[model samples]
Target: MRVQVVIIGSGPSGLLLGQLLGKAGIDTVILDRSSRAHILSRVRAGVLEEGTVHLADAAGVGARLKAEGLPHDGFSLAFDGRDHRIDLLDLTQGKRVMVYGQTELTRDLIEAREAESRLMIYEATNVMPQGFDSGTPHVTYEKDGVTHRIDCDFIAGCDGFHGASRKAVPDDAIRTFEKVYPFGWLGILAEVPPVDHELIYANHPRGFALCSMRSLTRSRYYIQCALDEQIEAWSDDRFWDELRRRLPAHHAEAMVTGPSFEKSIAPLRSFVAEPMRFGRLFLVGDAAHIVPPTGAKGLNLAASDVHYLASGLIEHYEDRSNAGIDGYSHKALARVWKAVRFSWWMTSMLHRFPGTGAFDQKIQEAELDYLTHSRAAETVLAENYVGLPY
Candidate 1:
């Protein structure tokens, strides 16, 4: 079908963009392979930055978020066997982040979109990108085993990192920047109550273990591990033992254990694809870049990317200004690279190398000490964590 914009992938980026544009009276269509809409909740990214919350509110989609989300002024840094709480309100006055899961945001947007008549789609369909510069930008796929071709004025490739959008780019014009670590993180979801009110990032000889809770009753936590580490390697009993040993601020802190609901592993890597656009097709979210989970920049950055894109596309359509839309690729790269650097720094300083020498270990400890002792260092971390709008 032909439309002003044909957005591929119904995840956060595409759905949010479509919602924003549709509210503006801009016609857009969203196509995905899933037959049913799904919420992205019950996963990762417990920390939400200040800027992201504002953007959601601006789009008129923050009602559920504001009601259900928790407000946290700051987080704690654990080092030297002690807890140092950096009150974010004290650091960045008045700007607060809400603690809401990515899945919750998706569910809100999904419900909102279900009431819209303009956005159309076929879930559980196979889609591919082609024939963009040749007049009609097309997404070819099969729905219910019947072949179909979707034509549009422009294509939003929100299919994510593994989708076919990246490969559609001319190899000569693409620049791939990558930094892979020697480790990965094993994230855990437990029905147990949270160990702390705020999230904690602990740097120890063992690895960088993060202490985070989803709600008063549900908790989410992560521990650093080897690249080759298997889920079976750490049984449920062993997981709790290591968590208690590494995350406690002191002997007084109590970690009420609960049954784990889910667990999974994510390989640590920093990646970005250059030019994010090729003719009429543009990429967003994981389709364009990937970041380590250390800084909690994954979902926030994707939201930022699509926010810019939706505005740019509006400019292009309403005012006949292709420059704003054309410059989207370049504009998005600025924030992407900055987050890449911040995420890499957090990852490098916390995770342990396979053959970490004594000097390296000492340096890591020293860096942690400086982060806690130095006010400027603390401010930098707070600013990055609270998130600055790019």
Candidate 2:
């Protein structure tokens, strides 16, 4: 089979990229090693940056998002037994974030693509990109005991960190930088309403806690815990009690507790692979970089990467120009590093690191205090939180 582009991975990045390119008259075939059910089952980020919202619209899947997604003008930062509101809209001059779950957005994209009969090969094993650097690129994979090949003008490595695409690059060609945090976030999804309308991020003596919601009726909460903490050790009551101790008295009092439908522990890490473009194979999203979820930059960074990749591909196909493609890596990495820095800073400020000395604690306290009282520091948080311009 022959197509203009071949996309690996059916996550939000691959789906979103294919949606944009398909609308531009560029034929794309999506290949994923996992079943659609398995892909949809995973719970991921719920916050959407302004850029992601527009990208969803461009992908023709924002109607339900705009209807159901909550728009938060601001969120609160709880520290020193109190709450400090960061005015996202006011600080960013009307820019706000949309609270739309990634799973729902993926479902919308899948429906849109299926409606148009886009070719998506699921559960395809041994997927590989070939000849990405020799001016001719193609992808091959195995499906149902048959091997298939797709000739394409370009390859999009949207498959995540462990996917075959990034690994296709030689070690010498890609430079990697990574920092794994000492703690992980134990998150729970409950049917109860959130304690507050907007999200609350708390920095307490115990650890870091986040009060977030997927919608008005569905709440998502996370608390920092040791890397060794096991899921089986945490029950609904124990989790609630520990969460309440981390939050302010009022929020804790107003909190609604219920049986958690989903629970998992996610380790924190910041990783980036240099030069997102490996010849004709352009790495998008998790294939290229990962940021800690502290600033909600993981999916947002992926959205930005998709934006750059799609724009470059469209320019190449529509205008017969390589300018966008030629500059893809430099431009994408420029923004990616900024986000990595922001997420790292936020994680450091909010979490209680292992063996953090008294001096380090005092420094963290000073930073939080300054951030709460100083307009300049608040604007920095607001700008990064709402997202940097695409």
lDDT of 1 by residue, 1-390 (tens): 667888888777788888888877778888876644343433657567776777677667889888878898888877658878977887776666688887778777777888766565756356788887677678887777788877788889888788777878878978998888888888888888778888888877888888887787888888888878899888777888887677655622687776688888889889999888788988898999999998889888888888788889888888989987888999898998888889989888877778998889889889888888888888887787788766
Off by over 4 Å in 1: 37-42, 120-124, 249-253
For candidate 2, what is the TM-score?
A: 0.99
State the local distance difference test value for candidate 2.
0.94
Q: How does candidate 1 score on lDDT?
A: 0.80
Q: Give the whole-model CA lDDT for all candidates, comma-separated.
A: 0.80, 0.94
Which candidate achieves the best lDDT against the true structure? 2
Top candidate, metric TM-score: 2
Clashing pairs in 1: 33-124, 34-123, 34-124, 35-123, 35-124, 40-103, 41-103, 160-287, 161-286
After superposition on all CA atoms, what RMSD does each candidate show versus the true structure? Answer: 1.7, 0.8
Shift of residue 97 alpha carbon in model 1, Å: 1.9
TM values, all candidates: 0.95, 0.99
Candidate 2 C-alpha lDDT tens digits along 1-390: 999999999999999999999999999999999999999988998899999999999999999999999999999999888998999998999999999999999999999999999999999999999999887799999999999999999999999989999999999999999999999999999999999999999988789999999999999999999999999999999999999999999999999999999999999999999989988999999999999999999889999999998999999999999999889999999999999999999999999988887787778878888998999999999999999997
